[model samples]
Target: MTHDEIWRALDALAAENGLSASGLARKAGLDATAFNPSKRIGADGRARWPSTESLAKVLTATSTGMADFAALVTGMAAALPRGSRGPAARRIPLIGLAQAGGEGYFDDGGYPVGGSWDEISVPEVGDPNAYALEISGESMEPVFRDGDIVIVSPGAPIRRGDRVVVRTEKGEVMAKELKRQSARRIDLRSLNPAHPDYAFDLTEITWMHRIVWGSQ
Candidate 1:
């Protein structure tokens, strides 16, 4: 690709991802000014070309694959939209479970709301993907505790041995490591054995799925 095209792609990608040139450079583990507009201007006032090494550094730091980078450099307009998915995931304010029943902590319907909640960002689960709930009790302690934001990705196929957040129809929400699942039942090990091992029938579970990630 032409040097101008490469530089422009870098600039556009950085902006779309909410990064400054320096920020994108640092994210990719390169010299802060590696893709700066000034760096592209030569002593003779012509634009300098981005070297292969610099391009490789940018690719590595952003975890962008080569074919995608090539598509970006080639002036394909589609690359712009793909960058939106890079870091813009769904996140919402989280409220501790203990405080959930307190004044102005959540809506009357139990949806989280108000000034007491802290914003917790997480990856968006596309297509019937579910939401998140903050952990509140010590019943599932050591692995998950009060105030932890648990990102639940329901509708994503669950595999055996994945750690999950399970909500029972009886209104108990708990985190457990999955051991096995059958059409009629789910076998799980509690994070806190003080609670005992769980083996619930599918009818008893209101919702059950993996915890993709979490934050303290």
Candidate 2:
């Protein structure tokens, strides 16, 4: 497709996901300011195309594919139309990889609060408390390697098979599968096949956030 067409599709895809251009970039783990409208034009006034990597990142972050993004670029109704710039889809707070494991980045309810965080944008998540995290460790290998970004929705229900981020009172926040939960403790299955299942006391857990999306 032509460069302008691809750019337009990116625009439509952002709208389809209820985010502004910059918001989408931030959610993709890129600089929150890189996709600003001002940068879309060269100093000489020529339209610029988004870099290949940037485009791939946004697509992955939004859980959208290139084919659909192409349809969006053409104004086709392949994807549902969302608010052009919904505030909820444009203001996702981002926690750094290192800081995400530290204290004060998450509230008692598993929502992000009270931390120095960067903001990003993505499609509507319905929860005002939704946030993003950048993966920086090899612990969650295969499923999520370093540099991947995952979106967490605290308000979303935690089902049996859903992937989640759980924080313990001992200051450990980890991503795992919710195998089961009892009043006393919770059972977790690791994404890494070689890792064994874990059980943690419910009281030892502080909060948990269900992962809604990821860019890996």
Highest lDDT: which candidate?
Answer: 2
Q: How accurate is candidate 1 locally (lDDT)?
A: 0.65
The estimated TM-scores of all candidates read: 0.47, 0.58
Residue range 19-132, candidate 2, lDDT tens digits = 887788888989987677777888999877788898888878998866566545533322123323333446688976667778777766777777488887676556677788
lDDT of 2 at 126: 60
lDDT of 2 at 74: 38
Model 1 regions lying over 4 Å from their true place: 1-89, 93-119, 123-129
Mind giving the per-residue lDDT tens digits that candidate 1 earns over 62-174?
A: 77766556645543223123433356466655555444335664333334456666766644434233346678778778877776776555544465655677666666666
